[model samples]
Target: MSTSTAEGRLLRYVDALQEAFAQEMARDESVFLFGLDVDDHKSIQGSTRGLLQEFGPERVFTTPLSEDAMTGMAIGAAMAGMRPIHVHIRMDFLLLCMNQLVNIAAKAHSMYGGSVKVPLVVRSMVGKSWGQGAQHSQALHSLFMHIPGLKIVAPSNAHDAKGCMIAAIRDDNPVLVMEHRLLYGTEAYVPEAPFEVRPGRARVVGPGDDITVVAISNMVPECLRARDLVAEVGISAEVIDPVWLQPLDIDSLLASARRTRRLLVADNAWLPCGASAEIIAAVLERAGPDAGIMVRRIGFAPVTCPPSPPLEAAFYPNPGTVASAIHAMVRPAAPAWQPDPERTRLSYQSSFCGPF
Candidate 1:
């Protein structure tokens, strides 16, 4: 059900993640939660609030300060018959456990010819500001995207967050769900019960003519705002939200591009060869040069996101930038105004060429 108000509920993304984990744990005894201070509940962003109380310590067990040890433990636990959900406060921290994710969990199914499966869920945070800086603020989903046997999920609103989170827990393959650092308080109308949001499918939020904008995660909200801003200037643009990044919804992209004949990509990733590059390239391959499609990506500038407010203001692409870009893309000529017949009679002779 949709809310009547203009603004949606403000449920934090961490809250959404915690609810998904708890729902799955209660649904299936095979599910278990693991991470640092998961038992603490209120200390870290209050994401794990009341989880330990319901599931108790066994399911919501805490880990020592060892990424390698716990990562290996999670992989072994998954292999030995336990669905362990590993939580990282920040995604950049996962790099220390890359070997376990890429080598063991990712390669195990293929190495053994599908004899085993690693149904593990790894949830991490990607913070750009809030003083987290380069170490903690990096949106490094591309790193996991490089690995073959990984299911990458990044949901924009509360509904997709819940749906994708439940889907990740049920997935037989390794799933990495990245929670945008800034979207913590963002919320939408999520189904009351657990739902499955199939991977590789994109959701078309708004339908329009002329242009199709492919947005990812938080980019979805930005696109919506941009759509409204551009509409004021008389250009209608469709917005597509790709919930799943890896098994991307190329079909939706192609369909929208073919329909609109123009594409504007908005993503959190940096320009050049990020996910935007791949999406744009796919359109070119399918439609060719005469497809009448032109793609301009809105994302973080080439420079890094410094903690400084001014630098970040310029670096991050907001709705204003998207709106401005849309205006430039569709620069309509102003309508010609006519004067009263009596007043225009004199001008008829002189107005032939006013400049002359």
Candidate 2:
């Protein structure tokens, strides 16, 4: 669909994903969907809800629980000119397929001297919910970003979610698209037809001057909440969502940093040597050290996520935590603004009910 026509509709994040799959599958004969319960009633948190009905069991089918073998099969299909969209219920499960992903799928094109293309899309979910605990709640984009031949994208909103998924499906290389579990229900204006958000771009969600807040995946919404809270205290925060992590738009990030002179990275992963650390280093290197810029990072606490509800709440950084961190970094002596505890608790849509 054209850009003008796409703006005429509104959609939930999960609906946008379903539309992307339906549109692409309708448009191309090579595209196929497979993973655990992709065609079931639950439909992988409803992202793949209606795919099987539209495309039939041959094109959209569920797979066995063998991540390694299934991933290898998808890689083989992609190598032979089939476009495969592999879905994982949890990003943590991606660890089981690292050998196929990092070694084979990621290295195929380069290892073969560009003689073949992988045209593979791996869709995985990463976010915290219902005390999912340490094993299931990891947002490990940093690990995939370290590899050379893979493209990694984490969309925060519905519009980008649809656009990026289309781009990944069409791209002739291996792409890992990470979706935040909490963002599946968030609604936004999306184009009715297919579109591409384009990889390697940084979108400034909230434009401000005092500081530039770079957020990733689910953290983008929390940062927006923080922006509103900080505004009451006269701190204007510019929020930048790095939609594509692999080919990161450093130019846009540096531009925001130069104008604000302060940057805070809010990522959903851990702190040490994480995406936050990499962004800080890149910004400082390009923006220059003499600029006297201040940089801080907020992410998962430097420990395993706790299973208890209250401890899990403390473990993950919420809007309140983000706002408090900004308040402290921007002004040391000012009275801290306290957000309502009830408001900080993250809520899921009624449709979202399980790990599947």
TM-scores of the models, in the order given = 0.86, 0.94
1-356 per-residue lDDT for model 2 (tens digits): 11212364778898999999999999999999999989888898788878888899999998989999999999999999999999998899999999999999999999999998899999999857676888889998999888999999999989988999999999998999999888988888998878898888888888899889999999998889889888887989989998989888988889888888888999999988888999999999987768777999999989998878779878888888998888887886888777776665445533456544
Pairs in steric clash, model 2: 6-191, 6-192
Which candidate number has the best TM-score? Answer: 2
Backbone clashes, each candidate = 3, 2
Number of the top lDDT candidate: 2
For residues 112-185, could you state the per-residue lDDT of candidate 1 as single tens digits? 89888898988887775545556776677767777899889888877777778898899888898887756666
In TM-score terms, candidate 1 sits at 0.86
Worst 10 residues of 1 by lDDT: 347-356
